[model samples]
Target: MAAVETMVRVGKAAHGRGVFAKRAIRKGTLVGLVQGKVIDDAEYYSDYCIDLGGTLSLEPKTPFCYLNHCCEPNCQLLLTEKRNKDGSLAPSTVHVKTLRGIKLGEELTIDYAWDSVKPLRCLCGAASCRGWIVAVNHVFDKSTAY
Candidate 1:
């Protein structure tokens, strides 16, 4: 809540649509909320969806849905709890935050670790690019080769 607004814009990425910073963003600043409808984990693979926790998922409703995966990402997803109108604690929701200072026009990304059900070819172009976007455990294990 560092007086920051939706400092992001959706644009073409190397793979597909991606979120880009509209202005410089300081590290640890809240970019925006990930609005979505709560759904069961069975529907997790649907478009714009993220796992909330065990057996639950969120189908993103905002432009954050355009966010793509990167091995070296500039942003991260965090869960936060807020009070409801009745002063009861609501279910935790995911928020996007900067991991470090991001320059204007830089694409916003997150390490989609351990969440992907199947291995995917990575086009993130990071120096440490793992070639494929898969769970960390599968990265170095030859048995689970990407």
Candidate 2:
């Protein structure tokens, strides 16, 4: 069997560690898979937890965890569910896909849209920067956009 080529690499970013494109990637490409330990506690919290539907969350590993946020992002996360023959639930998965073409060496980013307890200041530097790492729905005022 032929080996699959890697599409991303980890490197330093303005926001600390970040994922970068190893090659020029086209729009809608599957860039990476978010694999992690599944935490069943709905009340569990972490800086790295990713919602996996229902009462589950993912503590993503390595490359996936290093992906940072951008107000105007070039990537997006997609969650998919699986089921058994009996129609019961199975393990879910999250995929990182490109929303637009990504150039080699360009840092891959997603809209975190976090509704964090203590809202984090954003340094994504996108022209349309929301100024905070928060969900748009949580932004109530122009002055305090979180």
Candidate 3:
């Protein structure tokens, strides 16, 4: 929700809806901040929740919640934390950044690399698609070997 209004738009994607670049974006550009509320329990975790470190999670608002995954992704999630005056961690913020130069109209994507209990089949269509929405190390596990 913190993305510049003119910089991105939502459109049709292979998995339903996806975020798309509204203009050419250079590598390392700060695409947008993912604004959301902290999810305090695992039972509330949804597919849209972003893992904050390993213990915390965030459920981001629109635009960010619509980002889809691709094996050969052009973007990545960046987590930033500010320290509180007492030396404790403040709530972290997630930023989306371009991993490579992205052309205008290209769907913005990140590798989900989910370590799910029940992985879903991927339809990203990337040449190097891992086929399942799981972490790279788990992609070849005998139970779900690709």
Best by lDDT: 2
Q: What's the TM-score of every candidate structure?
A: 0.80, 0.89, 0.88
Ranking by lDDT: 2, 3, 1
Candidate 3 backbone collisions, by pair: none
Model 1 lDDT tens row, 6-114? 5988889887788899899999988988887877655456745677665667888647888998989999999876567999655578999999999999999998775
Encode model 2's per-residue lDDT on 33-96: one tens digit a residue.
7888999887998987888877888999888899899999999998899777999776688989
Off by over 4 Å in 2: 1-5, 140-146
**Reference-based lDDT, residue 18, model 2:** 93
Task: Give the whole-model CA lDDT for all candidates, comma-separated.
Answer: 0.79, 0.84, 0.83
Model 2 compared with the native: what TM-score?
Answer: 0.89
Local accuracy of candidate 3 as per-residue lDDT tens digits, 1-146: 33556788988887689999899888889888889888766566688788875457899888889999889999999989867799976668899989999999999999888887677778899898987888888744546534
Of models 1 and 3, which has the larger lDDT?
3
